[model samples]
Target chain A: MKVSFFPGCSLEGTAREYGESIEAVCKSLDIELQELSDWSCCGASSAHSTNEFLSVALPARNLSIAERKGQDLVTPCAACFSRFKAAEKALTCESKVDVGIPFQGKINILHMLEFLCREEFSEDIEKKIKRPLKNLKAVSYYGCLLVRPPRVTDTEHWEDPQALDILISRLGGESVFWPYKTECCGGSLVLTRVDIIHRLNGRLLDMAREAEADCIVTACPLCQANLDTRQEEIGDKEGVSYDIPIFYFTELMGLAFGNKGVRKWLGRHLVDPRPLLESKGLI
Target chain B: MELIGDKNFRDVVVDAVGEEIFTCYQCYKCSAGCPVSFAMDMLPHQVIRSVLFNQKERVLSSRTIWVCAACETCTTRCPNEIEIAKVMDVLRQIQQESGKQAKEPKVPIFHKAFLDSIKKTGRVHELTMIRNYTQKSGELREKLKTGEWKNDVRLGMKMFLRGKLKVMPPKCGGVKEVKKIFEQAKEHKKA
Candidate 1:
């Protein structure tokens, strides 16, 4: 299946692994990713917090660009997906404002997890799993944006989303039942409010460790960055040791698919994921 | 405690967020679900109540607005369907537009630096953003003055060595168009 992919700003920089893993997994699944041409930043938490118009306008521009291509839009970053979906809702419901170009919501926006969870792709994914992730206990971390404000995201089971869990199960990994699956990872606040992230992500890491999962899998770059990078600091501040490796769901998928490029993607994580994969004999 | 009874404060908040603040029935669900509520000077539900009471100063100056992560947990959990996160965003905007200083200055400073980065290159350059943010953030400036900024600089260098942070700015093909969007939004804000 072909979809217009919106690799938001993070994908180009700090979260480059996410972009690479998505490409690797898509290639393995024979899913065609047509990157949205000339897509700009989605204005994320910054634009929306400061100005409403710019928040809607920025994502609307990219949405309009994708709409012109006549393909459903997919974004790997949960935050970017939320922004695109929010912009679509705002532009469609509100009074038409001239945003340089006209935007009519002609396409659907799907998070990468949502795209992969589609029924048709299930059989294809199962067929592609060369190395079953048996005995690898994984906890799916949905973070905030993927399934919140149900009206905007239309996420099925917002509080206890099972998309990631089901995907993990299909990949032959055991999905651990955890309470903080959809918890806030203190997202963009990491840039300004490290204390908040430390407190919030500390709880998340503790919960994941309590769950005894081998790794925490995430679909958001911001969440991955926070949970992976701040684990050491949070551990030190809270007087606990946490060494759980955070993985982009796509990286795990690439690994399950036995794609060689998965190593390259996994290498970029702040916390190395190999020991855990090695411990499980999945590598 | 300073009491502010601006009658139009409620209307301004409602109009800006496009959500009816009065519809909130004090369910406390928003506050209960807020991850950062423990750190907020005013709880999420109380912020709404302040708006209802026309306590503009209390609502605008509260540290809650600045600390809100916009995680949408409160918005999602609100039984009344109030967009509490957006309300917080509008409060922050109101706070800034009125030229009142943020109770937590780092949040606004970081946001401005982020938007400035976007405005320049259509994408956030980690290095540029941190530089701009450290320059604008008084807290960071103080840290820099005391040579305590080395820790953050070390982290940046680590990220750089790890290839997580790109040294060069990334430009989108539609930077001109992005600038136009910002310009149009500015005009709308003025209108």
Candidate 2:
């Protein structure tokens, strides 16, 4: 249960709730999160989009540090998980990538969702749930990073991933089946093209609404922010109102575990999740 | 690396991406599955075709490469297993290096602003990054010129009130190492 934690950049600010809920839920599950000291950013979309070498090298620096620890490294951000895994894949597959650091590819880079789905943790999660989420229909949104390019993430059923849905089921919430679960939310275009993002996320929210999902559950910080914040504008422009709140998969786990810290963590969202949580009588 | 009839472009692509573009076979599956195709000037399949035909100018000038969100959905579903997202990245890097104005405009600005933030701080400071982006993006200036500029100050205020926007970035002990990685990576660029 002891794993090195890499709380990526967004977890510091925009996704603070995710970090808080992750820490709170892991404690409730008795999982020890050893902080990876002084980890750099995983280079997300920018590094790869600009310089291919930096994409591998920036993550290589972090992996070099984590590799020395010899423990499973888990990050809350799906983008970071993908970036770290990309570096590991390159280092393992190629011999010429010397980013001035020796990386042996000894550690397993795991997304927090992937970590939670571990058999030992999933088996024990049900026992710790003091209050099961009833009447909460959540559509698990994996976004793009966690499940695509299956060779890198090694995720089976990448097109229709069940990691978050299974966790939702264990938390006693109804995991609604939805096709837009793996759709891209245009996360990398957040600063560049808000117009494109609005349209793309509009499609996602529209599908979620049609799926009758009371709220969308996700693990990516950017997806949660984009889906939550821009939804109002998308509604105003499209004349189809959307009020669905976004939740980190861990936040729900913390709530189901009856962790008291989750009460504050729920308040950080742009589209307030508390209304739905309260109406469901789960808050 | 033959210099005849798209062979140079083909070799460059094969060097950066892989030879998968040669195997694409015009399936159009990648373009069909791409989520951001609505904003792209060229479809994914067409870009592959452009590359195969040595239409480097057309491929680089198009907004498709810059606008691609790198979602990798197209790459995943490619029957030929072409790494379409990586190809987009490769094309963008080439475009950036070409020193021409990006037709997609603000995306490259955002990318530069993001990387500079990372190079300076070992991580992105969102508010700072966005501030840098707005300052550098000429499209924003054009919006301002035409009085079409709609600022997100309200959104900023909302995020700030929600405690999502931090006024100051955290201290990162590994920032020096990050700069070193950037320095070493320059040698890695395929010249």
Candidate 3:
């Protein structure tokens, strides 16, 4: 299957591993990824709040590019998926629709989680798992966007999305179904206000740690950066040791793919996923 | 600090954003946990409480709106699901409409630059976003204030040299559609 990929800003910089892992996993699954040519930032946390039209237009431009390519747009970043999906909803709202884009009715905006959850790929993902993620108790963190602001991702219940858990189970890992799965990881506050993130991320990490889960897995680059990079600081502020590892869903998928350059992408993690992957013999 | 004795304030707030405020029983959970509470004269819960009491000027001008990262911890943790994050957004709108003397705050300035990047180019080219944000913010006006300015200059020079970051944004095919969206947003604000 071929799809247009939208790697938002973070993936190009701090989260380059995510983009690398996507390519590695896609190659293993025989899925062709065509990045939207001349794509712009999805405006992430900024655009929607300051200038709503700017946010919609930013993602719409990419959507139109994908429409021109005549292929569904796929994004590995949950934040990008949410931004694009929000734009798609805003543009299609009957009250105020954009007559210019030529969006027939609905534009196909698929999240990587949604794309991987397809029935055909489920078994393929399962078949590709060379290393067993067995006994690796995991807590799948959905972090707001992939499910929230429900108008866009109507496929599942916004409050309790089981997509990530289902995918984890398919890969031979045990997923702990916790209430905080759909909560916010304090989006983008890691840089602007690191203190609040200390409490916000502190709670989630503490919850995951309490659940006896080995590591937290997420699909958003910002979430990964927050949960992974800020552990030491959060630990310092919160006065507790939270050395928990945060894994990108694609990095785990890379292990399942066992494809070339898989370990290297996962290796770039600040919290070092190597120890966890090695214990499972996946690395 | 005293709760105003007016139902009109309560009614307007509830009407704008349904019963999310009453659930907040002054637990101070919002403030104690807020990362930006230190910067805010009014804590998260205090801001919501002010709005509940119709203390418009206090809530609108407080640093909370500008400082809030919109992390949603208070919203998620609020036994009320008051969505304090959404409330902050409403305060922003109210402030915008009231012409409450508030600029986009320091953090929000970066956010504006990012939004402007999308407004100009269909996509965000980081190099451009950084340059635009720094210049528009006048961060370069006093290089001494920012220790990172030297690093930014070096990175800018290196990125330009390697061509990793583009000098010009790649043209998106749907510039017309993008402009239409921008125009529509302005119309919505006017309406």
Candidate 4:
């Protein structure tokens, strides 16, 4: 299967490993990922907060780029996916704000999880798992963007999304039932108000730890960064230890599929995930 | 509570978000579902209430709008189906247009830095973004006063070593188009 890809900004910077692992996984599955030509930033959290027209125009620009490629667009970042979908909805409904470009929304946009969860990819994904993660117990963290504001995102289960959990189970890992799966990770607030992210992420990590999950698996880069980097500080503030390692869902897939470069991507995590993988004998 | 009905202010917000602000009945479900409500000066429902009551200054100047993560929890949980996050977005725009700086100055600084990065290179260069944000926010002075600047420097260095922080900005072929989008959006805002 072939699709146009939009890496967004984070995929090039802090979330480079997510980009690598996603590409590696797609290659293994024999999927063709043609990056959208000249794609720009999607104006995620900040654009909408600052200006509504800029928010819609930014993503509309990228969507117009993808429309030229004539393929369904897929993005690994949940924030980028939400922005693209929201922009499409906005531009379709409202006519006043001219984007100054051709953005008629000709193509479909999907998040990596949504793409992978598709029926055609499901069998291929299952067939590619060489090393089933036998002893790993993962709490699939959907965070906020992947499934919220249901009308815009059209996510199957916004309140309690199960797509990540289903994927985890298919990879031969136990999906722990946790209430905080769809919780907010305080994205972008990490820059403005670390205190808010510290508190919000603290609650999320605490809930996952309470569920006795081995590690947290997520599809969003901000969620992984927040849960992984600030965990120690949150642990200190709450007078408890939260050493749970957070993994990109793609990283876990790379490991399960026994991809040779999975370790390279795993090494990029702020909180090393190798120890947990080693203890579980999944490495 | 001073009940000042500024319907003009309410209409601006409604028109900006393209949603009826009066539809909100203030069930507080949005406040209940908000993850960062604890840090907000005004709750999510109260933000809508302020808008409904046409308390323009109270709604726009509150730290609540700036602190919102745009997580959409409130938007998702609202029984009235008001996109409260979109309402918050419009409120932030109103705040910026009225020349009222964000109560949490760091929020606006970061947003400006991020958009500036995009405007220049069509993508956000993290190093450039951080440098621009810290400079704009006067965070360096604040950190130095607390003697935490060195630690902040160390974190940046650590990220650099990990190959997570890129020093060079990346440009795309659509830079011209991106600039045009920004210009068009600004024109729309003016209209």
lDDT, candidate 3, B59-133, per-residue tens? 766767876766555665576677777677666654554544564454566776776776676666666777666
| Better candidate by TM-score, 2 or 3 | 2
Q: Model 3 reproduces what portion of true contacts?
A: 0.32
TM-score of each: 0.95, 0.96, 0.76, 0.96
| Model 3 chain B weakest 10-residue run by lDDT | B1-10
Cα lDDT listed for each candidate:
0.85, 0.86, 0.71, 0.85
- Candidate 3 at A147: error in angstroms? 1.0
Candidate 2 total steric clashes? 0
Model 3: per-residue Cα lDDT over A1-283, one tens digit each? 8888887766666677777888888888899998787676776777655554555666777777788888889898877887787677767766544635555434488888888788888778878888767778899998877776564556457667888888788877899867788767767554445566767788899889888899998988878878877776677676877778888887777876667786667566666777876777666
* Model 1 / residue B69 / CA error / Å: 0.5
- lDDT string for model 4 (B94-142, tens) is 6776666779889988999999989999998888998899888998789
Model 4's TM-score against the true structure: 0.96
The predicted structure with the larger DockQ, 1 or 3, is 1
Given candidate 2, what's the lDDT at residue B71? 91
Q: What global local distance difference test value does model 4 have?
A: 0.85
Local accuracy of candidate 1 as per-residue lDDT tens digits, A1-283 = 7999988888877898888888989998899999888888899998888887898888888888898999999998888889988888878875654555667888889999999889989889989989999998999999899998889998869989898899889899999999998999888888778888899998988888889988999999999999988877887787888888998898888899998777778777778888888888988
Candidate 4 or 1, higher DockQ = 4
What ranking emerges by lDDT with the best candidate at the front? 2, 1, 4, 3
